[model samples]
Target: MLRVLLRTNALDDRVRKTLVDTLYTQPTNLAIGAITGVLCSLVAASYAPDRIFLELALLLTAIAAARIVMAVMLPRLRNRDARRMELLYEFGAFTYSAVLGVFAAMTVWYQLPATAQLLMVAYAIGYGTGIAARNAGRPSISIGQMILIFTPINVALWNGEDLAHRALAVAIVLLWIGMISITMTVFHTLRDSVAAAETSARLAEKMQHLARTDVVTGLHNRAGLNHYLVEYMSRRRAMPNLALFWLDLDKFKDINDALGHQVGDRVLSEVAQRLRAQAKQEAVIGRFGGDEFILACDVRDRREAETIALAVLADVTRPIRIDDDRLEIACSMGIALQPDDGEDLETLFQGADLALYHAKVNGRNQISFYDPSMSRNLVRRREIEAELRLALQRDELSIFFQPIVDLSTGRIRAFEALVRWFHPVKGELRPDEFIPVAEETGAIITLGNWITAQAARAAAQWPDDVTVAVNLSPLQIKAPGAAMGILNALREARLPAHRLELEITETVLLDHSKQTEDFMAELSAAGVRFALDDFGTGYSSLGYLNKYPFGKIKVDRSFVSGVNAGKKSDAIIRAVSGMASTLDMQIVAEGLETIEQVQAVQAAGCTLGQGYYFSRAVPDYLAGMLLARERERLDGPKRAIA
Candidate 1:
């Protein structure tokens, strides 16, 4: 019996309902046992003289009321997980059944009528059966209930001092033993069924957990993220102000390819841990697989979301170190604010994703928010990227020539070749729009080679003294066969290398790679002069001027545009001009939009000038006519002086 009570742990392992169901029939047994006790009390009271019925009725009433209370409370406890409370209900039922057995025993001890004794015997037998039915789920408790109901009655019958009573007790004891055996069988059967059901439920729950979890980071998986987003959106009808940030790890693939996946996996885990630490507890952060992670938080507006996005981006870029190698990671975040970006999760995420594309395109490791204008821009960019591919093959691309004049004489000494795209359907797209798309798609290589060929051909057709300047993208300078491409174009067009000048931006000088250095060296060695374009706007150091052999420096138009404002602009131009003179390099002052601007650059000792003040970039045929008129003007003066 103590063993069964100590098997509380076993009961804990069982389903809550198993124990609850075991007590389902308990209420009925309690009521039936109490009724039998009351009936026995009534029979005793009726037979007794005057006052005996009062005490008897009072005792029966107390027992019946207690039984009624327990019966009501026990049923309410069904499916309750509290095992001790369940055991107390079971004990109450056992005690009530035991009292009923004592009632039948009392009939033999009190010398009641022979018919009454037979009735009491029958009542005890019925109560015993009820015990078996009620306690089947608990074998040890059933044994205890059976003992309480049958033992006292059997002992009283045997102690009656008659052969007939003794024989009746023996026969009833045999039946009682068989009931106990059946109770044990039923108890084991019920317990086994409960265990099996509980095990199955637990297994299913574990499978669900595994499906929604990421093994590497223990964060929510992509499916889990989607599930969370669905739950969040469902509750966000009237108050749908949430920020969704999609972060992509910059240069993560390089680590995976260079250091093996193990190192990459470690890095990803670290990133996840750091992000979790930095995010608010209510925020939902999850891995969307690979190098991308998604974070979401409910906020009032874009400013709140932007703050979170910036914090997350900063968190993501923290350094991760393994062994001796420390990797500085960077993340670009695209933010979309709900109700502002979109009401639904799908539309919001799409906006965020497009913004992410712009972040990576504009220069990575930064955060950007979604704007309606971005959608239009993205559409146009997509159109340009698609058409630019076809434009290279279809020869739909053309060129415009802007003259670079000698600052002293205003002679058109050279023409800067600018590429223009005339889309068949979208009309003419500017270089800023299509060139970036082409560069992103690696179409710049083909486009660049074609530009070189075009420039060389045009320069070959011009006067031998006139030169053509072509701008080079950073990607072009980084490419391996860039010098070869330009050299071949010049050879094919029968143009002299001296007549073709390649202009490069400060970014090309800052590449720091041997590839960029070798490319510049190769082209310079082949007689193609280099001009530093947008020199002062970017990180133009004096060291670069001494290191790279540039034939000239084009002062960025931003400073040139501000020339008339104050001496500040003139001061910068003078400083740049002085540096160029010391290095024995020419200066081409760009963006000379006014005669005052031209005069400022000329006074500041600029060797060349080019802007709208001279003439806007014009078509090839018009450029040739302008060049002819300028040449005639310069020669007419030369002939008069001679």
Candidate 2:
């Protein structure tokens, strides 16, 4: 039992180290033990005055002095091998207890003076108790010390012929048992506490990591990005030049609408991987939100930032394959430089966002660096967006009509309704000035609905044969209840659905969404004709013409302008007109400003024309007057026949 208790293997390595360190933590405890042991030895020698007693006294004195010296030097030796130091401390403790035990036993066995014997026994018990209390962190070592000290003294008392001495020995044995129990309890308590603390620390670290990581892309999330910014800013003096790049995937929404969100998530993950591969090792990258990513990296100047931005754009635009689909995606990047754009994260983010907006507005899949003018433009846009909201509520918007003429009869077929904002302070604002802002800010839904209703009401006032064409924004087409809303507008105006023609650009077909298909199908079933506007300006696939129920295809203004001037534009118009004729779709030549251009489109088989040559867009009153004039002209021929 003693050998087992003395072995160090019972405690874990960490617990053992902590216990050993605790043993030497209090030099005052070591000093007290040394002083008491030396005094006890001297008292025994003074009482006995024999050769063995004196020699034992001298040896105990030497050992006590050495323990004192060790305690004094402990601080200097703390940096040395811990295991060696722990062994040294244990050896010194055991030797001191063994020597004191022998000295105490001799005082009793030799029948020394009663005062000396009592003193020695009392000293031994006191020292053993002290060891139990002080060294309880290491139960084995503490119990071992108590056993060595008390066993010899108890043996000497039990060997005596006196009854009182044996009773004293039993009492000492009880005391030793109690001390051992207490030491074991203290050691277990301390060990369990350390284990709990370590466990909590590990749990806290894991939770922190989870909080900072993005689940979808396995990159840093917004919170993680904030953390990175804080840490980087702390060391900003060392790294003065930082380039913040904001990236947005162009037409990613089309992908999500056409495919699904699951595919969108996969694409985002792939994009993250590509960014990781292309970014510098020191760069901190994060996914800010849907389809948006941010990167902060060290760069010397705008030139280096531009170079990196171009490289990233090139790599990201490469084709990606998912399942059976080969998707080619493009990314627009905006860069803001540190100290030049802003010193902190908030300002830097604002600058980068402004630049990104500029890139998207100019053309997607390009890079823009921050400039002061972009900020002014952003402010102007915000003013427009805010005022435009009020404009909708205040009825500061109106519609104008551009007539589409039939080339064969030189008469009006339909009038396209175009929205114009008459700002009180800014006068009449063109659609191009505020329409993009409305579309981006989600105000187009309400505005587009208003236009549809107003156009329906105005068409009711026009000649029964003249139809009203209203252009639909991509947002308006994708909005819920869009078809129902248009039908409601026509119903409220008492206008037949046949008189309402909807003009849509090719962008609406890019999504290939079920909602859009359903929207078109519902409206088409209600006798609302659909025209493919700006037909050749976008993804001019003949597939759209075949898939969608388009009654008319309007040649883009660019092609109409080039007619009779270049063979390319003329050839494109001729081919489109021939295809439309085959599909039984009317072809309208747009942007015609000259008789020669009009004749060219007529000869190329275009049945209709609309441009400045016909008439610029006019208000509803003027449109009604023009329809009345056309009606009178048709009546004049009929009256002549009468």
Candidate 3:
């Protein structure tokens, strides 16, 4: 029964058909050989006597030998067309076909009664036809092949030869066909079902990958990285020496602001490719959303891991291309080693991120190993950030106006607006301490807008002859239509554009030079003037001095303070004054502290100056009174030289 099922099972159509063809062909050939041998022997039985039977036997032997040879050699004939395994199946079919022929011939040689001879003949024919039908789409059906010992039981019983036997024979053939067909159907269904299930599973996996992976850089997102960390923790016992590296790109936002987002995307992809190439062979690298990337590795020790990290940094530090532009991108890397940094996944990640902060703080584009104290610093920074947001809401900030003096006339011309924060509980906070924190936390936008508005309002109450100068943060300039915001505030305050000066640092100009230039050009067109505040500090200032129509160039305190101390300072001031003189630009020397410093700046031909020697930054009300007193003092100077 197993053999029959194996031959007929629909595991594969080709194999089943090959087996059935062999079975059917064998019986057909056998029945033909048997009938021929029997008829020849019986006909010669009367004429040739004993020799007649021998002759028939010899013919039968030759025919059976031919059949056997054909069975064995048939596969070789189709060797080029059939696969090795398939050809083997065909050979087995041929052998079965020959076996049927030999069995029938042997029965004839035995001189069995006509009835038995006929039965053997019929069985052989039925088996041969079944074999032929296995391979061919069409094959001749043999009535003789259908009848056998089983056939007599069915045919003979109906004719009163043996009713019970014939009925059992018919039942067995029907049951066999039914079992084989059902088994074949099951096998076919199983194969199809498994194939479909596998395809669906693969498609689902691809979809999940797309969701987790970054489309431009092919890195995992923050959510994906979080899940990866969780999975790592689950098997962390086995990977006790695992390490995670977190990396963030420096000045990436500048690239987006300068170039376009399209180029930025290309640059990011290039960075990702470089990272993937240089990362440890065993490490899993992923993007932790936007300019951040992550690497999880299994390392033996700190030394081994540092070597990998150093290599990665070196490779990534190389220039990358975004179309026609080449960018020098660098990453600040932080390492957290498992079982050492922290036992749990979240703690380990937090430690690594904190270390990354240290890398950025000290100087970007460097690496730092995770330390226990980093977590403390991280907590403190988070607290600062929260407080900063609160400070903006509670109006804990105050503005101080510093006088801009005329170095030659010794009279104040305008006031520069400076911001000071009082933390209520923390007493006073300097701009250097809190300004950076605000910029990093994106609080600068709100703070800067308020400052601009406040300064404009305060300047409105000042004499028409005096102007207010406010410095703009880089974030503010890049904050989309920032010039419009300034203009709106000035208009709302009813302050003329000429009465409001915007102090821009050399850093802000260089950071987004094109944007800054465009903004300055637009506002300058509207009659608002630009001052190069803290000039002589950055390399781009001298170049910028010629590019835009600046109303004034404030001599950086470094130059102003050391004017009498060094020839270089004096020459710098003299050259700036000379340049302003030639271009008709006003020169304001800041930090004029003494009689000598004031004389030097005035001698350098600077027209405007400001310093503590004149007046420190004071409240709006005090500044108004101070301005009035300064005007009176200038008008009443040298009254009683006594």
Best by lDDT: 2
Among these predicted structures, which one has the highest TM-score? 2
Clashing residue pairs for model 1: none
| Per-residue lDDT over 1-642 for candidate 2, one digit per residue giving the tens place of the 0 to 100 score | 456455545656665666677777878878887888788788779889678988888888888888778767875763655567677777888888998998999899999999999999999999999889788766767987898899999999999899999999999999999988888777767777766776787899888878988889988899999998779777744455899999999989878988999999989999999899989997899999999999888887788889889888898889999999999998988889988999788999999999998899887899999998988888888999999999978989989999999998988999999998888898998888899999999999999999999999999987788999999999999898899999999999999999999999998888687888999999999999999999887588999988989999988888878544467888888898888889899999899999998999899889999999989999999999988898789778898899
Which one wins by TM-score: 1 or 3?
1
Weakest 10 consecutive residues of candidate 3 by summed lDDT: 137-146
lDDT of 3: 0.71
Global lDDT of each model? 0.80, 0.88, 0.71
Give each model a TM-score. Answer: 0.69, 0.83, 0.68
List model 1 lDDT by residue over 14-118, tens digit each: 565565556655466567667766776677656644564446455655767775786577567545555665576566656655666676676766656777677
- State the displacement of the C-alpha of residue 488, model 1, in Å, after optimal TM-score superposition: 6.5
Q: Which of candidates 2 and 3 is the stronger one according to lDDT?
A: 2
**Regions of candidate 3 where Cα sits further than 4 Å from its true position:** 1-162, 204-212, 217-243, 250-266, 299-307, 321-325, 330-340, 354-385, 388-393, 511-513, 560-567, 592-607, 636-642
lDDT of 1: 0.80
Provide the lDDT at 439 for model 2: 95
lDDT of 3 at 146: 30
lDDT for 608 (candidate 3): 87
